[model samples]
Target: MDIDKLSIKKKRVMIYFIEAARRLMASEGVRALSIRGIAEIAGYNSATLYNYFDDLQHLTLFASMSYLRDYVSALSGNLKPPMSSLQRYRVIYETFDHFAFRSPEIFYNMFFGRQSAKLPEVVVQYYALFPEELKEHFPSVRKMLTQGDMYRRDEPIVEELVRDGFVRPENASPLSAVVPRLNQTYLHELVNGKDISPEEQHRRFIAVFDYLLETAK
Candidate 1:
């Protein structure tokens, strides 16, 4: 296989698998994600998936990366002509909420329900939406760090580049990394598996999220 041809072949296989996974999750939920089932869904044998990925885990990871990329693109489209960094972040967040609600089976299956927490590099790069999509998530995060206000936020406020957005910080990541690093503080088992009331779960998760969102405001 020549390099270009090999890339094209791989791309088609990946797309087929992504569609299969999406259909399965749309109909049967994440638990429906078995190697056999995905193979069937893609009109190929399980062996084909092996050629593209080591196992079902990698396949699903790839699907998730593609999904997030499409997700950000779609949300960005629904926003005003050109949105600011904060605006872009907020739009994507709301889009996430909507997508989660509409496709509970698929969304839950891909996340929270998966045994893996491995976010692929490709996924991180495309949905960035900030200075660069890969680290676009950084600007909002860095913004949070620089501010010490109920909102007296101001470090480098200039509208000299990128049109709707500002030039990204020269010194970034020290504080903003904490935003994307939020999953580090979250505990799924404690919240999802326990006998706690709904209110309690809301209170706990909200508290964590509130602190984060508050700083952004």
Candidate 2:
């Protein structure tokens, strides 16, 4: 009967619905989701779901945002806070490794599922939610000024690397943008029906991830 108790219950219910939405999206795609489907998944009546979320689109975005938040956190993984820019780079790769290793399905969906994810707002928001595509990596080139990390000091050299096209901006998704194709082709060839070990898949993905990072570094 207490208002606080009621609020807590509502929050818990919303969390349930968010998770349900993700599974439903992955299994059936966003087009198949409806109030009835989500309600069934959440073990609630259709009208009950409306109490916590405005509508199906709102619910879809909430679920997508939750996934994105978790992803950003994962990118930081086990690193101490206040990571150096180079360390930050490692964290990003570490996040890539974690996702590639543990939940490639969700990781695959995060990018490939965008068209089917069905929340235009969520899609638009997440296009930029992509951290590697962010412009922040340009300034980070300065981190090379540090003695032994990724970058090197000499201004003319850095400039020549930049000028001769050796250095690509970090925001550039030279490899990432093509991941859908790579997955369709390379990764599928390696896995799909094969009895590939998880370690092998992890190694393959890390190798690809490292290859992309090598140029930017």
Candidate 3:
């Protein structure tokens, strides 16, 4: 549903559910989320949640995006002027690595989980419902955030590198394809692994990401 077209009361109800899910996620973490738990916290029954959301994963995705506020806010500071495309790309991913590693399961579910395909619509719906999170970013950064598909989001960056001669034209496609997958692999490990700290995970991801960039050049 187009969130803007929803009746005011319906939007309010949806916000209640989304905010409730966010509180649950913040307090107990992603894996602990349950429809009944969210509904109870929102002061509604589980069936009412279905009226506002497609399913548990749908609601979860909406709730998960609150975690990205830090990432979007930090990106503007890292992406200053007088930087090469390669440098800008590094800064963007490094900033992402810092935050994503902190909440691997949330990031993983948002981008790679079963409901991943609905991400584009969910992003539009999410920001429409909570425009404040979308407001702090610069125009370009905001564009990046709204790009729901991870591969499509990174393509333009790789294309810019190719245009600037930092990356070979022939290498652009492969780099774009491989980079997200590599990030996904590491993210999967971080989400499921028992002992690794976020700091270590970030370092390891950057090492591999930097190595891939070097080889792509």
Candidate 4:
């Protein structure tokens, strides 16, 4: 559908629904987001949301993508280049961690709201929402994941390391298997409501993530 052809009032209603969903996620967590709840908050009837979104998950995921835009926005004017692949890799996580800490609710919703840790279809849809300027903050491997299937999701990063001479060709499979585990650990810790300081969080992240990098060599 050409959303551009949508009437201004219709566009405004869609925005209201999406924003209402976001407000709910921020205040009451992802589980609180229901079509009726959103409609109530947005001053619309329950059935009205169907005109804007296909289902509750569609609106919820759409709302979640705004947090990603915020994450990308936070990285604006922040990345310093001339770093190694490993360094760039660290920056990516650091940038994400910083944003996640600052906006715990949204990041938790984005990373841990779904039952399956991976949101392949939603991730693919959200990637298209990123503006061109923020596109550079995305790692090459992330681009690969969004474009391709999630099986062997870490393969591209390992291949990049091999291309950079950071990992030997033969060690690719082992390294790929282990490197993504660090992310799993980090996300698990972040959403589990662990009572750790931001400093401590970074410390733990560096310890495990750096160890993975070391083992990759």
lDDT of 2 by residue, 112-149 (tens): 44433333344333333333433343333323211231
**Candidate 2 steric clashes:** 1
Candidate 4 has a TM-score of: 0.68
By TM-score, the best candidate is 3
lDDT of 1 by residue, 1-217 (tens): 1223456567677668767876776577565789899889799988887876656655565555435545545554565756665554445445554554444333443454452343433233213212243444344443332233202111222222223333344323322444323432333333334555434543554466446545433
RMSD of each: 10.3, 11.3, 2.3, 5.3
The TM-score of predicted model 3 comes to 0.88
Question: Which residue pairs in candidate 3 have backbone atoms (N, alpha carbon, C) closer than 3 angstroms, thus clashing?
Answer: none
lDDT of model 2 at position 75: 40
Q: Give each model a TM-score.
A: 0.48, 0.43, 0.88, 0.68
- Kindly list the per-residue Cα lDDT of model 4 for residues 1-217, writing each as its tens digit: 3455777788778778877998988888876788889999999999999886667766776687655655555543354567776666667677777776655555655555552244455554444433352365556434534554233345765677788988778888877776556665665675667788766787787788777777767
Off by over 4 Å in 1: 1-3, 7-18, 41-44, 61-70, 78-89, 100-174, 183-210, 213-217
Candidate with maximal lDDT: 3
The sequence of per-residue lDDT tens digits that candidate 3 reaches over residues 124-208 is 8989998987886788768767765442458988999999988888899999999888888888898887488878877887898
lDDT score of residue 132 within candidate 2 = 46
Lowest summed lDDT across 10 adjacent residues in model 1 is found at: 150-159
lDDT of each: 0.48, 0.51, 0.83, 0.66
Rank the models by lDDT, top first.
3, 4, 2, 1
Candidate 2 Cα errors over 4 Å, as ranges = 1-16, 19-37, 41-61, 64-67, 77-87, 115-194, 211-217
